[model samples]
Target: MIDLLKAKKLIFLLVIVISSFLIITGCGRDSGADIQSAEDNSFIMNTLVQMRAHGENAEIAVEESMDRIREIEYLMSRTLEASEVSQINDNPGEFIEISEETQKVIAESLYFAELSSGKFDPSIGPIVDLWGIGTEEARVPSQAEIEEVLEFVDYNNLEIEDNRARVTKEGVKIDLGGIAKGYAADEVREIVKKHDVPSAFINIGGNVLVVGNNVDGSKWRIGIQDPRRGRGNVMAIVESKDQTIVTSGDYERYFEEDGEHYHHIFDPESGYPARTGLLSVTIITDLSLDADALSTIAYVKGLEAGMKFVEDIADVDAMFITEELDVHLSSGLTGIVEITGPDFNLIEGENFAD
Candidate 1:
């Protein structure tokens, strides 16, 4: 009878051990699945701003990041009467007090204008307003009108001191449309970091800034938009981490008239849409602001010069899609870029080194 009792006691302890092991294993699986993902979006900066994050307070972090974007839009938009940009534009000849954000943006704009030799100018506002390419009133402006506004499109006429800015030329206006979204992306990144988010990404109308790697600690795959195809159609893919990707394409903001497509990217010299022999230019860099401004500058520089320009810059990679659907990538992106669409031919940029 004692021997029988010993056997039963051993069985009971074995059962308890098995049950504990199963419970622990089940909790381990649940912990892996508990990594939550949250996403939120808002329409701001004249584009759709999206935020995706993975963490404990991801929802709250996304909400706060979007609020920061809206605040930037309100401060920088030229259409808003009370915006600092409008205030500077409304009083062109006089020094007007502006916010610190406005001052910083203007300062950065001037730097880029000098860097690109005026290829990316903030003083092209008058010309942009005349064409109104993205607005309902978009129409072809006459050559006479173009020439008249061309005089007021010089970036050198603008001056900044402390928190004040002045446009020496009368009727000269400043527009932040080209670089504002990029700045807003940087701001969103800061907020996400403050929330201790391990991984996050912000897409402000295709100006994407990835905060870190994927949840699995892998690189994020970013698609290069096919300029000729519809939205979400990509010609190639770029895998990266903690980078900003900005693309300037003819198809992004354009209007069709008489079978000719006129895009929003204008030449400061011609006061007309740039005919740069390229369909789109994508810039990848550490800062979204640099990527944003460089994409426009490279698009304006055309294919040959654009390729050289990107190669000369440090810590910058670019992908150029030509009119013939040829894909060209900078030296930095030679091995990293993969052509996904069969319609496009890959013309490696390393072959063009001078």
Candidate 2:
């Protein structure tokens, strides 16, 4: 598991600001007359893990959920040398037997890899490690260096045989950083619900999943961070109940050199940061796993195609923040999604598509 005070996540800087990326807003009053609530946070899975729940068993529910997240980090975190993911990545082309939990997330990763046709791939580790965007060694590699690693970035090359998994190609590897947290969030939800907690707020590195309404009996109001602005500063507020709200943007993990900015989210085809002309893409959905992967796909697809891609999915909505700071809303969130960023212009995404 990701040990406390050390991580591969983009949060050490965020460590000071805690709520830098996403903020839980508008909690009215205390826990009320007779309600029990528990809230706590820790650094794990390369990001800060925050949990809050209400009910008689809120404390136990939240604690169990946090423990589950730790278990996931132990198994899935790529930086952990003994982790299942590392084992698979370290010995490419060899079927490394993984835990059911590891296999489950990897299989789902393949689903998204196929779903987006490799735009969002689990095999993006080679390029990710080469750039090292979020680490102290972060640097821009030469095109030849990028091209050399590109051959190993194909999701199609990954093969899963039941409980065992392996990258078919020798140079290929798997990194679940993109989708693991969401899976963990979904797992946390189950833990919370099983304990009979009526409400909870799970913030795994600003990727939020809220269960039930606020204590005040109103919808949970969440603030979406302004990608360029500092943390804890929000551009919009979303009212969510029993749903996951997450974003994938260039601002997450990045480095700047010679006036050029490079972020962690990569374009599988380009082998570099996605130049999708999008500042950030936020997905609001019932499943955090879906929202997490969808946000990345939409961001990599760029604004126009990304909007259309998300619109086709039923019961899911997306908010596309373009390079121009223009807020484009999917059909479902058109009239909704309150704008809180003064410099942001809320316009019809359809018109922007034109």
Candidate 3:
């Protein structure tokens, strides 16, 4: 449940996290040098990569990597008839055989669901569909309709065994939109890393995963975008060697009618958007997947509560922007997160407890 006010003010869309280059492992010791390539496809809704020995057979490696990404997209897509997720949605309460790839994602989703106290539930597909904010036909959903949809959003209803998952509840639905891109990014990074590319950065549209710094070994600098623009307007820049900067904002995806604004990211309790005072939450963590989930949770939890929530979590730093554009930070991230642009200000907090 990301804060309703922040969600209303923030609109987000799914973006791919494909890096510009690949990481070359054992670069100087093998048969020729290894080079990495990036590919964008409509099929996976993200980017793909492959690193091969720099020789005549490099094209084959590139093509194979692209195809591997497509295969993953086919198996995990919710819109596809043959996708495991679609099948699960089609036949609830039945065990669905899924690829180990899909299973890993499910496990991570469940882990974050527990960590966020169900605030970052992935079972928000019904509510998402009802609002239709990210689609062409976006509209506000009624209270009764949202309430009915909420009944199907219990993340605990999903049961996983080995490589299969079973949805015990009838109407229970799952949507990986929040965490899918990050997971996909992580997967591609591993794929490229195994191939031994020199250095890389995966920008799944906006969700960025840095495998290594620039080719010269400098820290990768990523600019946090300003939420109130169509272009990718950066608010500030964060430098990291090999880490992720994931942001969840109210301006990423949304629609306006009369004076009301509606978007995705609903609270399970009220079946409406969360009411947290923050406008957006950005997480910086070693793992992009965790950063992605925590951004949603922090956005829903507001300033104080969100700060406390992230404090207990180790090795994770957060930057929170409130509705009025006030910026707050977790202790570890205080001075390191600089505010850039005309609309942001840094403020200190005495205590941020729920």
lDDT of 2 by residue, 192-294 (tens): 8898888888889868898888776778888888998767788998888999999988876787888888988999999999997899999999999888899
How many angstroms is residue 259 displaced in model 3 relative to the true structure, after the best TM-score fit? 1.3
TM values, all candidates: 0.89, 0.93, 0.82
Of the candidates shown, which would achieve the greatest TM-score relative to the real structure? 2
**Residue by residue across 1-354, what tens digits does model 1's lDDT show?**
112443344334433321110111122334436777788756678766667788887888898998888888888999999998888888868899988888989999999999899999999999899998876677898999999999899999999999899898778999989998999888888888898888888888879888777666667778887788656577788877888899999977777788788889999999999998999999999999889899999999998888888889999988999999988888888789888889999985255558
Query: Considering summed lDDT, which 10 consecutive residues are worst modelled in model 1?
Result: 18-27
Using TM-score as the measure, name the better of candidate 2 and candidate 3: 2
lDDT of 2 at 35: 89
Candidate 2's displacement at residue 255, Å, is: 0.7
The weakest ten consecutive residues by lDDT in model 2 span 1-10
What TM-score number comes out for model 2? 0.93
lDDT winner, 1 or 2: 2
Q: How many backbone clashes are present in model 1?
A: 0
Better candidate by lDDT, 1 or 3:
1
lDDT of 1: 0.82
TM-score of decoy 1: 0.89
lDDT of 3 by residue, 80-199 (tens): 778888888888889999888889888888998888889988777788788877665677767788878888988998888998897888888788777877776676567656666545
